[model samples]
Target: MNNKDMKIHLTVDVWAAQKADARAVRFDVFVIEQKIPVELEWDDMDEHCLHAVAYDAAGHAIGTGRLLPDGHIGRMAVRAAGRGKGVGAAILKALMAQARQRGDAEVVLNAQTQAEAFYGRYGFSRDGEEYYEAGIAHICMRHVFS
Candidate 1:
């Protein structure tokens, strides 16, 4: 990795996600980039979910993910500039760590259809038929570990 890629740091916090940071990153990736509706972007589950945020060296929020008590991971988003640079992986590792700490043997998520392969790299296996959420196609997936 180059200097720019190596300079970023990953921070994972359970129930510690800041609203401002989550909104900013979500706005950049989901709303502006993916054209997702703002009203749908933010939801009631946020307040009850454990969120993880990744920051670039300049202190900009570059990635975000959330884990629910039932070990459901969702809303994983990496900024355009931060994509393909390990931010997503790092954030995922952090979320898994949170799950492990809570004694979860696995984590589940409804992944976007276009991103199934990406989640597969992290050991998430498709478990059900394709479904729609927020007007986008998704697949139910889960990560199992010993």
Candidate 2:
């Protein structure tokens, strides 16, 4: 755990001022860096999703992810400066903890093909065939609750 012990204390409301950092991190990673279409990067579902934003020691947001009400996790993004420093892992652990607290039977995500092993390291199992979304390869993965 980092400074906040991996607790995602940001407001889940998309309209909240707290969401700006999360949005910035995602936009930088998905839209600018990955070239994902802007239209594909946002959705109405964000209004109801639980979001987790990771902050660097300097208090700048560096990573983020969301856990949908239906237990589908997505929008995982980490800035280049934040990768491999456990920022992604902290955000993910926070999101999955939120899901478990809500009694979700399982947590699911469409992980980038390259991140399959990373998610697998957290007990997520891949399912179905690989597919392309926003021109990036992805595979569905799930982590069942015990």
Candidate 3:
């Protein structure tokens, strides 16, 4: 269906990182779809982080991401069906807004190699060499607002 005809009502909400809705979306995208090991998927940092979750018209979580206390953004995930429909971008934008509200000087993330361009569109610039995490290629990116 065309973008307008799809009628995909997406709502992004920011909340505590450990909220069930956020965790559910991350589990589906990161662990189930990407096969990231459980050990690496769940971390203690979640409790202290700010998370954003995108929910569809049916109230089902479709995308999620988080901003850590140190200005690091991670755990970004969008369901397969949610890709290319602006859901990921929405999630990222919400997290960035949260960072700005907190007075962060900069925000950083390890972007999956293939998704670097996506982050770049949001003003994030590559900051370091490419590296591997969870067997996936990633590169450090940062967006400075101050």
Candidate 4:
């Protein structure tokens, strides 16, 4: 269905980094769909990060993202069914809110080349030349809070 015709109900929650729902959504989008290595998917940093998960009306996790203590945002993923439904934006917003609440002056993220424009819309600007991570093209992006 087209976006306008679809019923879009998204609930975003911020929690400790290892929350199951957040991990599940990231697994589906990153490891499963994008083929990122399992070893790279689960990292030591998770325990110290702030996580955001987006759930649909059916209570299924649809998207996830994380904000690191050093103001780095990463691991953003949105399930295929949730694409174009604003689920990713919801997840990012939740992460950014948490960052602001923590008194961060800015947040940085490595945006997949194809999704750079998506982050750009949120006021993130490219900070470096394109590079590869997990064998996929990416570029560093940063958003400064005013």
TM-score pick, better of 1 and 3: 1
Q: Give the per-residue lDDT of model 4 (tens digit) for 110-129.
A: 99999998999999999989
Q: Give the per-residue lDDT of model 2 (tens digit) for 1-146.
A: 55534333333434254478888998999999999989989898877888888776667888888989999998999888888777788778888999999899999999999999899999999999999988889999999999
lDDT of 4 at 40: 87
**How displaced is residue 88 in candidate 1, in Å?**
0.4
Which tens-of-lDDT digit does each residue in 2-114 have in candidate 3? 56322344443445533888888888888898999978998888887877777776777788888889999999998887788788888788888888997998999999999
Clashing pairs in 4: none
All models: lDDT?
0.85, 0.84, 0.83, 0.83
List runs of model 1 lying over 4 Å from the truth.
Answer: 1-6, 14-17
Across 67-140, the per-residue lDDT of candidate 1 in tens digits comes to 88789998899998898788888888889989988899999988999989988999999999999877889999
Predicted model with the maximum lDDT = 1
TM-score per candidate: 0.90, 0.90, 0.89, 0.89
Q: Identify the runs in model 4 with alpha carbons over 4 angstroms from their true place.
A: 1-18
lDDT of candidate 4 at residue 63, scale 0 to 100: 77
Would you give me the overall lDDT of model 3?
0.83
Instruction: Flag clash pairs in model 3.
Output: none
